[model samples]
Target: MFIKIPLHISGLWYPIITNNPLTTGSIGAGINIALYLTAKLRNTEKCGILLNNEEVLKDHSRAICGKLGVNLSVDEKSPISLGYGFGLSAACLLGLSLSSLLVKNITIEKATWPAHVAEVIYNTGYGDVIAEFYGGLEIRVKPGPPGIGVVEHIYPGRKVDLIVSVLPGREDTPSMLKRIGKETYDLARKLIDELLEKPSVEEFFVKAHVFTSKIFSYDNIDKLLSPYRSKIIGYFRKKQALVLWVENEWLDEIYSYLNKYFLSFKTWIDMYGVRFENTS
Candidate 1:
């Protein structure tokens, strides 16, 4: 069995804050880029994981070794750096849950619940699991487990290219939420409402820029993108990274610039969410 799950790029999300600590997911409104977690089952003398990160073994992936001789290994790319839009934590858990279908048949909703709960418990992420579960640019209207939480997707009808670059930094999502003043949250919600009115890839980023401005300072961003700011569809700093949604014409120039200064790559947004296949 082989499964591929898309990573969530929530560099832009309006957290749905609540008093209850257990219900602490966000109202995420952003699309997913093509970075992935790939897993496959193979026959081997002993069940083992061929991985570079020890945390994967110490935590989520170890519990599901299944029966002996069932060799399942998951490989992730780009090794989502610290404060780098989740470091693909949700993607790793989702892949593990999806692979369980090969051992025991279960509904998709059932598969995703554990992954979402684990994410919340560990404080690694919030609405990202649900966001990746649905794919596309989603507004998580209800924040909780997958079976109960509801998401409204904004379909761009075409895959959009998003340029990403990680910087050495840190962002505590829960702390960031607490830091946001009520005025900012309310205004961001109003922006979301406006997005639903005319939801397009272009418009989503246009609004994202406004949302980002209220939360953080992007002074360095202006100087870096001065020459090509006009072509930018959306620009924001998230997870200690810089993500830009831009017009295609200037993609190469901007990409080159990003590569020169930061660890950058270009990936496309997908609406299909997570996909898996039996490769044994």
Candidate 2:
């Protein structure tokens, strides 16, 4: 049988790195896309990670499994491209943990730390596991794991859709995290305060785009997005990837407009976070 888990993309974030994994997370906002991972699970004496279709993540998966203590076979049907800011690493860890725990009859509460700790140790992601685990659009005010971190949800007042456009090349997350300077973090901290004041979904994209522009050379995509900006709600970047939020009525027009400039995918906001979808 297989278990499905929700996937997410952080709209804007500032990492809160600390020596302890429990306290390590990001202060940011994200949307839970409808995309999910299908993990095949079974009972076994030893934990095995058949992730990446047994082609890659052997070591990382094994290490995570050793901590969780159950077997998992990752199905390739979930096609979240790595390093394009889809938050795949954390998603996989959560998927693996959930699958493992399901077979063992353990509470899902035990699942997050192992995945979160792994992300911290590996320097793969911050705030993603917790945010993805919770679902919906959130402004993560505190840094750390779920119970340790604090997040405030932003109700857009109406449901919206998410559009993802991955750029030509992938950016290394660890390297990107390392390159973030203190000035940027300082600026982001202040931005977080500003976001908290009148935090609406629309304000998030506007402020988040400011942070994106500060770090990356966003001029190219910025220009490409200009004409469609008015027609859509708002957008922000995570490295080379761009995520656009739009109203349901504008979905067709937005896709048609982006067709000339980029290859994009569509999914609506998922209010529910990661959970046991089904087993079959």
Candidate 3:
């Protein structure tokens, strides 16, 4: 049997990186992109994972299977790179968990809890599993395990094209978390509150750009994309990639300009979260 799940792109509002039980909650809104997962049950008791045509470490997936008492072989394909703030790790866990749920006839909450726990325990991500499970643009109001966290969705009426460029390397999220202090957290909280007060597509880009610039320096990015400044709404750094929000009408021009310098693609919002299919 096989199951499929969609991948996600979160515009991280507030990146929470601490393992400290009190200070480690994140706030972000994300969209489900075209990238997807297909998991087939293996005859053996072990689990395997393939990411973007490349085999990856299956420790997390194996951990989930060990806890749930099921085995799977998963193939996840995407145009983007893993650990680029595209929520690939979270997607994989959710896909495996959902597949286990369908094949084993387990409850949704029970199936998904392990994925959430795995992310929190590994410091790979916080709030992404919960946000991806419930589709659309979501805000992580409070953070903890899947069931313990609180999230709310903000629906922007119009759909826009997300022009993403995966940079050369990956960002170590745990290391990034270790460097953050209370000042950064306080600023992020204030910005999130302001955006939530009157949530709109325009406001989201504006505030997100501010937060990104303040936290991670965008001086080089500003100089690189100077010519197309007017057409671009805003840009932010995600893990190790740069994501630009552009109006659908300006997609071709913006993409053309960005293509010359980086590996770029255009994708739309995915309202649906994880899905299941049985191919026996």
Better of 2 and 3 by TM-score: 2
lDDT of 1 by residue, 1-280 (tens): 5677676766445554466533667665776777666655433333334333443533544444442113455444334543466437777766655655666577877677666666666666778788888777777777865676778888777646678877556666657666778787777778777877877777777777778777777777788889888887777765566778878877888899988988887877767777876656
Residue-by-residue lDDT tens digits, candidate 2, 95-156: 66666665576567566777788888888888888888888888898987677888888887
Distance (Å) between predicted and true CA of 275, model 3? 2.1
- Please tell me which model should have the higher lDDT, number 1 or number 3: 3
Collision count of model 3: 0
Deviation from native of the Cα of residue 280 in model 2, angstroms: 4.9
Mark the regions of model 1 whose C-alpha exceeds 4 Å error after superposition. 11-24, 41-53, 57-79, 157-159, 172-175, 278-280
Best by TM-score: 2
Clashing pairs in 1: none
Please give the range of 10 consecutive residues that has the lowest summed lDDT in model 3.
37-46
In the predicted model 2, the residue pairs found to clash are none
Candidate 2 segments whose C-alpha is farther than 4 A from its true place: 42-54
Clashes of each: 0, 0, 0
For every model shown, what is its TM-score relative to the native structure? 0.81, 0.89, 0.86
C-alpha-based local distance difference test score of model 3? 0.69
